[model samples]
Target: MDTSDILKKVRRIEIKTRGLTNHVFAGEYHSAFKGRGMSFSEVREYQFGDDVRAIDWNVTARFNHPFIKVFEEERELTVMLLVDVSESSSFGTQKQRKRDLITELCAVLAFSAINNNDKVGVVFFSDGLEKYIPPKKGKSHILFIIRELLSYKPKKKGTNITETLRFFNNAAKKRSIVFVLSDFLSDSYQDALNIAAKRHDVVGMHVYDPRDKELPAVGLIQVKDAETGLQQWIDTNDKQVRDYYNQQFSQHAQYCRNAFLKSGAELISIRTDEDYVKALQTFFLNRT
Candidate 1:
């Protein structure tokens, strides 16, 4: 896409996602993710319900009145969007491609983070890291991120979550809220996820197409693996073939669920044709 087209798309996404953030996600996001710790705000006269432990003896003595140190949650946070830009994410037989859905999801999260005064960044990855946008605050940074998501072309077409997670562990110096959005088409990343979750808050945003789970009954068809560039013929007419294909998809889904659970992280699955907004809202509410 050209610069003009990219800017238009970014503007569209910003308008939609920012509205969602303001109306639906702003409060939910804040409740879902907590601040690091409490910080002292100021000193004020003691109130009836104020905690006695917060009493400021020095200030009380000078004023000859009982005073308490007021504190507030340190609400600033860094948010990382670990997005899959592999070839597989380009597929969808519905309203939008998986890539498009991922873009919108990232946009919504970015807006939500910014609204909460949090810094937002993104890591576009395929078999390895494709691009890293350092965490920063501001509307312009978010617009740039949306533009990248809409136009980024990965160097590698494969998926390798392990490498991506390892890179994230080293790159993010401070703890962050990480949303890893992918179809979970790759495996062997459980160890890396576990390690990362130990330091930063991790949540897996599993995005997939309906075709990824089942095959249509069209007798026979040719299919290709987007990541490996492997082509093959399949007989959808054969019940065995359909069953096997479904089993494989189920196994992969199970593996993903188990991995996130084992790592003590959260996972939210959204299909390309499904109500992603509802899925996201439910996830945020559940997190709360």
Candidate 2:
């Protein structure tokens, strides 16, 4: 895309997602994700009902009076967005393409992290790792992320979620919150997901279009596999063919649900045409 067009798109997303982050998600985001641990703030005179274990023995002995250590949650966190730039995300027959919806979702999450004073980073992947933006805090970094989300193109078109998760595990040493946004059309990623979830807080966002679940009776149609670039003709008018297609879609959906469940991760499903804001709000509220 041209520089002017990219800037325009970034500005548009910033205006929409920033407002939602400020108004709808600020509190929910804060409550859903926790800090590293409690850090000592100061020591003060012991108050009634204060925990006895919090007493500062040194300060108490020095002052010849009881004092308690005050501590607060260390609220800084690193949020990683493992985004799938596979070609499958380009398909959508709704208000926007699946890729566009994913971009907006990433923007909202990036803004929310920044609003909470947390570090935000992104790992863009397809069949392989495409780009890695190290975790950092600041509005400028977030804007750069949004800009990349809107304009970056992937070199490969296939999906390999395992590669993305493995890259994350090797690159990030500290515990972080990872949101894997993809259609999840690949297989053999269970082990990678299991390992990553044990190390980080992992959430899966499954993006799909309604047409993926069922096909319309539009007679024979030519279909193309977005990832593989294979084309074939299908008889959508035949009841048996339609039924088989629906069944396959359902099986894929079930696999995704079970994969997340087995890994002890959360899954949020969003349709391309639906209001993703409401879906995200519900997810955050449930976590909180």
Candidate 3:
């Protein structure tokens, strides 16, 4: 697309997603993630309902009274959007492609963070790291990220979740709220995800298409692998063939679930045609 077209697309997404944040997600986002990073503010006399675990023994002994440490939520937070820009994102049988949905999702999240006075960044990746936008707060930064999401093309086509996770963990030293947007087609990232989860608050947003889950019985058809550029013919009418295809998707899904569970992270799935706003709202509510 041309520059003007890209700008228009960016503006459209901004209007839509920003509105969602303002009306629906603003409060939810804050309530869900705000109180995570707390800092010691002061020591005060313990209240009747105070938790004994928070007692400040040093202060209590000096004052000859029960005292508790008070902590305030750190206002500044950094949210990272780890997006998958692999070849498969281009394929969607619905009204929108996975890339398109991913762009909108990122836009909504960015606006929500900035609205809550949090800094947001983005990482675009394929088999290798594509680009990194450092964490910054403001509408301008979010607009710039939206522009890149709609226009930036990846140099590679395959996906390596491990590579991206490792790079992100090493680069971002501070603990962050990370949302990884992908279809979960890769199979070798469980170890890397575990490491990331231990350090950061990780959530895997699995964006997929209906076709990814099931094969339509269209008699016979030829399919091409978007990443490898390989073509193969398949008899979709054959029940066994369709079942096998579905089994593969199921296996990938099961692995994705197990990986996130083991890492103590969160995972949510979205289809290209699904209402992503609702899905995100549900997730934020669960977090709260």
lDDT of 2 by residue, 159-253 (tens): 99998999999999999999999989887899999999999999999999988888999998999998998999999999999999899888888
Cα distance off (Å), candidate 3, residue 172? 1.1
Whole-model lDDT values for every prediction: 0.94, 0.93, 0.93
lDDT (0-100) at residue 186 of candidate 2? 88
Instruction: After superposing candidate 2 on the true structure, give the runs of residues whose Cα lies further than 4 Å from its correct spot.
Output: none
lDDT of 3: 0.93
Across residues 191-251, which tens digit of lDDT does each residue of candidate 1 receive? 9999999999999999999989988889889999998989999999998998899999999
User: Whose TM-score is greatest here?
Assistant: 1
Better of 2 and 3 by TM-score: 2
What is the model-wide C-alpha lDDT for candidate 1?
Answer: 0.94
Task: Score residue 53 of candidate 1 by CA lDDT.
Answer: 97
lDDT value for model 2: 0.93
